[model samples]
Target: MVNFRKYISGITVLASGFFLAQSTVSTVLYTPAYENQKSTLNLPSPITSMVEKAILSPKELVDINVNTMMSDPVLKNATWGFVVYDPKTKKVISSYNENTPLVPASTTKLLTTETALSLLGENYRWMTQLEYSGSIDENGVLNGNLYIVGSGDPSLGTNKAGAWSYKEIVSDFVSGISREGIKKVNGDIIIQTALFKGNISRLPENVVWLENNNYYLPAGTTQEINPANEKLIVKKGNSFSAEKKYFYVSPYMNQMVYADKYDGDGILTTKLPDAPAYLANSFKTTLVKSGVSVTGKVTPRMTDGTPESRKMISAYKSPTLADIVYYTNQHSDNSLAEALLKTVGFQKLGDQTSESGRSVVTEHLKDISFDLNGLSYVDGSGLSRSNLVTPISQVKYLTSLMNEKYYKTYLTSLPIGGQSGTLKRMFLGTGNGQIFAKTGTLSRVKTLAGYMKTNSGKTLVFSLLVNNYSGSVDMVKKRMEKILEPALDL
Candidate 1:
């Protein structure tokens, strides 16, 4: 009461200080210029449009891009097909030319692999038996031919995808022969190739034979091998070509079927005249390296006709059929794929020819209720020009895979984007591991089929096939990537 004026002045100063501190804190917290003004807190139109596009529905995006893809000048005379489906809902989200039949190329491996996985359980193994028809004496000498009867095993000496190695093969066979009390062979080693009935022709693109006695590369690839070291130095070339081709070989390498020739894009490949003989030679060399002495030559024959009294000495079992299929599909391995196809025919139709394999595949597709109005299968590896199928049929087959008991194994066999297999260089920097697919390429045809994971956690299956394109194939791939880009956004 004595100093009312002074008391009022002190209270006003305290209130002003408090208000200033509160204003400073608000300014520090609100960074955007628009945030300072309550009425303009909304984003600008450009930023808002980007946000909307990022969240666009899968169907909406497909619809928008399909039209653009169809109108591109690169596809002037091309027959193209595209389909996207939802497995959970069993519905087609988008499609364009989905019913048109197109050459599938290596994508044919998909059908071959799927059929094999369904018929042959995951743990099924291919067997190569080694036995002798005659007896060994007390001095450890055998008087009969050692026979190798294969059930079309493509993994005998291969390490690319199989679990068995050359060392294991040598050890196992040596042990088996030792267990039979045989220290020396007095007869020739014969590789019987008629067990499967049909003969397989060598693919037109194989060029290199590895030191381990396995053919490691297929057609459509080129590598520069160092002549001095017999090692690979460069591995770059077209996967498919019509006008130009090139391949390389190391001069110091062993186990080669023939000498290297040609240096340009016109390299020609010769058929494997005698596969059984080649394998026999490789095995003979391995036996010699393991301190086994033989006084006989390695030979190939059509039939063993071994008497029923022949004793089974040893057998080499391949890895599980599932693992083999995984490697086949992942690398687009033509040899393995064709072998599996023939195996399927042998199992189902009692015939091992490509035509018979095609029949088996046709029957399988029908059993699965796939619409095969224009589908065709001429060979298991799709190296033949006779294979054809529609995008719609492929989509249906892929969707049906989800309901199968071995669906997980089947899916894992496909090439993961930017992660593994043939798709390692594809979809880089944009969906990378999010896409798992199988790629197919011919001179003028390109195709991609597989499963994709969306940004929203939804899974989509798609098949995009393009054939008879007029421009460069690389250009077509770029356009296809653009068309599929929206799926990543979804």
Candidate 2:
């Protein structure tokens, strides 16, 4: 419930941080010179008096706008949950069905990311190690299997911002091997993915899978496969040095895989059933091209324990958790969000399964005293329609973070209105630069939750969740914009 402030003469400043002017008419409509000109306009006295008598508080105006939108034909049957809260006064400014749980869409990333940052810290990094099981002889000829150990790093070999490209990663590994005086005879390239012990398929059941799109498969799934009808094609040219030879093959049974002629960056688009195996194959190819012979093929090994004799040769560290969180929130990256959720489970609960991650997030929320009534957290990314949260709960969770140590990191990671990420084209007029929030969208669902700076220089946290609307997504967005536009003056 809101505490309404009484209106006074001249100017009234409410404790709720809104300024009101007690005037016959709005300043925009009635200037000082309008007193003399009012008679010339020949307006009816009753109409002029009615215009002068109409004065509404900010809260009342927002309520009117929300009620009007709720009654609109397009949204007559929609379930809406909205809340605007002030941390300073510890008050709810405006709310509509705030306690009703609704599908949150991508806004679930907010929970996944915030939980990760709280548990993993800002500077935490994921490490992928290059190691060998056998020993190299004095002649640098005898060797054992080379192991590419993974710690469930999602950014490995990705083109994510601030992440190393696959080419660079391979080059570093090759250089490190060469520096160690290892010239030849690697038995095989083994990708070790035992860190996440069981069941690596992280996608929720409700997420839709598209054909010919890139997907992150289980840790040890095989990425490269040759179609029976397609033969490996090798073309020799004058520029092809002994150190570089191109082998083009159909990496996926459904799609062809080829290396960049100039850089050897294998451009892969199909779902990588086994990312580590693909990387291991890449390492084998590069090793052979660099004059190091591999006697065996690439393999993926999933064991609970690594041999004590294995020696680490090199390591690649991912960008810090902060960078990953920023990218996840700004872009609403589903894969990264899932990875972070699994990592949180692995780090805190010793299991990397989705259930474990969900439990971890639920426990974290409980620890923070957030109300769990009518809340259903199914997956890290809200791609699953099973995810549900009330608008009041979201606003409460957001308000609780104001005093946290990582609040700055969390706040800056959200998309800025009309400036960056998903919100770049939104809030282009008055809401521009005043909203720092996350946007969520799914079929018949749209959500927004974050902080807003009002025209009166007051900061407010808000959440607006809508479900089952009978209109285009763009139409819903326009209505949402209208509702938020009035809040800009609060």
Candidate 3:
């Protein structure tokens, strides 16, 4: 017989060692599995789905979200052109019908502004010079015509913020003339508008006119006058006054004409005729009021070329191009947008017609290697329904500017979602501050294009163009917000 106590001790030690090894294996495997199971059980379906989405790549997430948005029954009859791109990676994240051209509305301003920023630069300033072709005599008399030389400065006499008001501009001109000690002018006040050569009042072939009462007329209709019953009323100012008034007129009329009783209800919104002539008259009136006598009448000369012998008294510099661009994007100012287009044309192609501007912009797009296969660029402002553009092309154009020196200037000029500009009242949700974009709207079209900052600190360029959508535009906008809001957290 062996010693029973020694045998028991050896068995006990073996059992203890086996138990320890089992514990180590359980901690290494079973504990984590149990914890993971418990955590997964505690998460709801929505939370689990969110977690799954969080792990997906940006492209994957964008694709899923956009696919879902496009599949909605409400959008069954709508036409869409959308694209999201990553400039840093030079990759397209998601796209749906992006190559199809659609009416871009005010988003066309983006093209105009981008071209202006690229060619003219941010510091560019338009100059409106106060010049005289004749000499000033010792008797404080000017022997020549006082010319208001316009460089197609759109904001020349406007009262936009950061710009001189009409009153202030007139005052400055008067002061400039008084400083020269010219008490009397022997010649007429001539308005030189030869800077823009083509039809100054030209409209796109597909331009749509919207009356003040929200009536949409046929394309290419400049006015909505009842020719059989109403007569055109013409108003002429007799004296120089600091107050400037805007009058609506038909495209054919060069002078300010009122419709019927001039209740301010007419087609072709914000259409002001003979702006240069109006400015010239304003100068004449102000000069006379400031004790400078003019012997000749105010004349508007639309022909080209200024006299080489003309001397510049003072040049009124406009706010920087960046400032003008900021205002243009913020307000979606059609006049300002058109001015920028013509300006780029004048500076780049030496021609200020709308056609020349379109050419310059198209060439710029080509220089940047942007495919223009489906582009039908008609006007700088989206006032023309004929201005067609593909969403992909817009996104590509926007992405190309990311590496540019003026990128910051261009980006900041856009309206910030839920904060300022046209988007001030929109995107109050997750998109607030995350979106800096331009908003475009027309009868049946709604578009948005710009930069979006994702939750992961990535910047994306995107364009969403919708045409011929059924239902209210606000509903479409809400759907658009829903689609964009998800990308914010991606």
Candidate 4:
């Protein structure tokens, strides 16, 4: 949770630091009222100080430069600057165009995920029930159709043990009938996936495919992907797996096979693929079974519906919201985020449709007083540049989350600074593990906003927004990420 007091303390630090540099730091631009306040407060970082302090409230986040550091030589060639805020005094540290609204990209997930967690709570789970719309005789034969209802649970079959709800659903049905002294169904197996209503063939064309594929599978199913494959796919010669940690599906696995010996939970000894999409198009890959190999085509389960309805036989629980939150933060799992968003909205709107979830969230943000003028949040994944938000709005909403009715549990869902979750390995080995923040990226936009430790050992709230750069988008964002190393290094 963000501290409200830090905001005020930052102002105090900036007020006194302004005059320390006095005549030498006179080049900084200032607002009329803000300048008056600076003079009245008569405070500034002096040249003799060991640390160069800069704070960007709203106006400077959009235009921070390397010059803010007064030391980085590379910043002269850099695209945008930074917003440095002193924690002890809540004031504008040094800033450049902090007020501009830039494209937020995945950073927008921070908004959507936080909103969902705050309003919905972390204990919330998805419900995928096994229902039958057919008549079952005492002999154990189902005369009609077995309806497979979808509760839009993304975590279904995503157990740490590895399985899917569709498979789980069938497994449950088999067990229920076996428990009932029955062996098989006399009628057809009818699956009713009438859960979400929308187009199913081609997904709505968008920039966030990697992010939104979870919740709304093309609004309709076309390609059948392994439910949990979006994350890590451990295969022979795949690069996604490290010594102990397995990363997301990288681009190098389309043409590799695994040795039978790799599955014992040791390590990926083969070379990793350089790219992640190598496996996306290979719908006809073979998997090894019991040290042997088997090939199969990807199949989509039937979701057609019939008039008959039957009671649920067997079902399984999806992953808890706690794990989902961790995924959302660590990998910036947009798909999971979207799935959770729609599930909550579906609960309120009577269905798991994306449109309904979008509506519910938008309304809720409004209820909490989020600024909607520049924010065009469409999907929860932030895959769309169509979605927008200002730094001030981000901080304001974050403050609200801290005050939520279930703040303690909700806070745990968020990743810890350098300690765990997404921030892990970020500030690692830098002794900056105390810093906790979320990283969001997209072309032309990047953001690092959350909590950070300040010079005085007091907690500080920080939001860094970098937009409108002219370099390779990824490289440009890398520069944005590097800003935090120094900001939190103190």
Candidate 5:
């Protein structure tokens, strides 16, 4: 999405009041070029009258700083776009190449998270129901299959030590089923996952690099893993295709890790090909320990054709949508963001694919009057390189959110500079929670977007996106800070 426009002859300023497609010709560093000169880097209109008036405003200072920083030699090859808008006045204070679409990276989560907040209310929760299709006899032995229908709750059993962990959820299920007076089950435990439609326990196609990734788990009796096994490598293979263990392990990572014991709780994950079967097995094992018996194996199905006589045994409810959004944006959780997108697609478009979800997002943006002319919303998590959005479009999107009822909730969920989430290490000792934003980074891209309160006590929505910069990340960051530090105090 980077606007790779390069000029070699004359300087021209676009309608956005900022320079773009400047000359790449070799010249002295920071040398100003005029329209009548040989290069395309246009010098701005001189402030002859302003100096004659002998008056200076913060906006003028910002303009000066932005122009100075952007004219550096290092940015000669960079494709950049930025916009600073006053939400209250609905006016652009300053902008440069704002309409140029660029890769947003994880900043795409803003669209996903915001769409989720607007579509799915704050109180919405994903529910997993437990039910049975068969009946129990007088000897406390049952002949029916136990069923678990998932709603694609991404946080299900994520925190191993939390109350809603896998072990805890399984314990709750076992106790509830045991209270039904059924001591044994003669049939297999059925896992119903029709709510979500896609590959389970595996990375999405766009994120194939995540394959064979190992997640560490704590060693404890409460946890399902053994103390000696500290790592769970998520891989894609079909060695146990006949059985339920369709997930493969990384032979290399397995051999490298030799844990004699573990000290903390493990990470609960569903990186298997069949997550329902994994859950069913974990549930079955815990149920047996809790004085219940199951003689059948665990299996997964995409249907819930139980007869009308089927009864609900118990259900687990997830945290509210607001809390989920908090974690999703704060941690930049790619999986949760994708899940939200799919959920949006499933609700609005009756499909769960990323394409469908992005369509839903586009529709929502249309409803808000966002200019989507050249923008592309491929995946919600922004892990894909296909996402493209202009800084002007992003600023407009942020400005429109002020009208939403959950605007405060959405703002609170973003990372506060130097304080929370991904921004904890950013804006240190400077912005220090004054900036609420989302960061996007890739090999040659760096972006920051959100709201920042200026020293004059006015809130401004801004987006700064730069791509193809030939410099170290820290160097670019320092340059970005040079521009932002003055703006933050504007």
Candidate 6:
């Protein structure tokens, strides 16, 4: 007696009603924002109403990307990004592609440094210890081999390595050995740098600033390699024809008396780094005109690290782990990042080997609990395309840094905008640097991630990452830098 057609119609209506009801469920449930107060925000219609009402009816935060704003070709084409967070309301304002994982380039360092700060601390410095297993006498003469141990010193045999000259490290080793009442070593000097345990790749192919052959950490191997000293290399480049040739000066203890003229052209690639490699290689170009070579000489090394380095006496005591982290964040040194990653692995896994170290770091990051899928990390130095990260996880890592005691120190440790470090002169005229955040870059990827206050004076964390795009990075950089300026007027 029942009508089958009627019953079917009834069920269909019910399903439709259910779906419509579900659609009606407010998005404000997830994101915190004042739909009305957010009227000023340039967003879609549905989200605008939702946000407007949420401000009137409730108070909280979340991100809702159930819209086409992000997928919109115009916006998406202009900036390959998704941002949802308000510094003013301390909540997620809007989002698109929020979950899509994108390569963050150097922005990944924010995560590495921030995670390191929370787990490692600000007062931490790398320790370069000196161990000797030989006999010394009152005559200041060593009768055995002097072992110099390295644990990934970012600033060894380079000025930033320790503010001391390679000569000083040598002198310190001699003085320390002398203090230990020893001179005239009768045994070989063995430099033991087995601290880091990983395969380090060699320097990049486009390297030009090897002002000194001291930028020794190539990519594929991982071990605590020590440069001879804390030397900031200086190279002067001359534009010979349309080509450039450079002469390098070592951070010798002796003052450089370059009182000569009659050079090639006026281009001094000075301030080249001595160690922690990449920075040193940053000073060059290829022989475009062909048949171009450099003819520069060291004032005269006390003696390079040839077979003779075996007899050099020295001590190896690194700074605290915290100091090491600060230096890494501030200077943005690549080799140093590799060393720290290994150290973290060694610290966490209890095995000072690269395999274990990589595992430890990976495991620790997983413990972070952010949903980062398809993100692979082989080394800490983002030098590897094998490394991957999502915007969400990196932000989570930064948020975790808040729990640290020296978090302020950690914050400052980041290169400031337009002031010092990597970011110096970048956003200097922005007036925004009176307060704001960080920047990171590498081949094909550009990212700006960090904290900044909104127009309401409430600080909000944001990250903008652009990857795999074929265009002018310089233009992209300009566009990215301009976005943060007047928007909040910060």
- TM-score of candidate 6 relative to the true fold: 0.60
User: What ranking of all candidate models by lDDT puts the best one first?
Assistant: 2, 3, 1, 5, 4, 6
Candidate 2 lDDT score at position 424: 86
How many residue-pair clashes does candidate 3 contain?
A: 0
Q: Which candidate, 2 or 5, would have the higher TM-score against the true structure?
A: 2
TM-score of each: 0.74, 0.78, 0.77, 0.61, 0.75, 0.60
Instruction: Please list the C-alpha lDDT of all candidates, in the order they appear.
Output: 0.69, 0.73, 0.71, 0.49, 0.68, 0.47
lDDT of 3: 0.71
Colliding residue pairs in candidate 5 = 201-272, 218-266
Lowest-sum lDDT 10-residue window in model 6: 279-288
Report the number of clashing residue pairs per model.
2, 2, 0, 54, 2, 60
Candidate 2 lDDT over residue span 79-134, tens digit each: 98888888898888899999998999889999999999999999999888898777
Window of ten residues with lowest summed lDDT in model 1:
250-259
Model 5: per-residue Cα lDDT over 66-165, one tens digit each: 6655666556679888888999988888777888989888789999999999998988888888888778899888888888888877677665112186
For model 4, residues 326-407, the per-residue Cα lDDT tens digits are 6776667655667766776777787666778788888888888887766777777776666767666665555556657665
How does candidate 3 fare on TM-score?
0.77
Instruction: Residues 307-376, candidate 3: write the lDDT tens digits.
Output: 5478888888889999999999987776678878888888887888877888999899889898788888
TM-score (C-alpha) between model 1 and the true structure: 0.74
- Once superposed on the true structure, which residue ranges of model 5 sit more than 4 Å away at CA? 1-55, 160-163, 199-274, 304-308
Query: Which model is ahead, 1 or 5, in terms of TM-score?
Result: 5
lDDT of 6 by residue, 458-488 (tens): 5556566666544445444544554444333
Enumerate residue pairs that collide in model 2: 221-273, 221-274
Query: Which of the two, 5 or 6, has more lDDT?
Result: 5
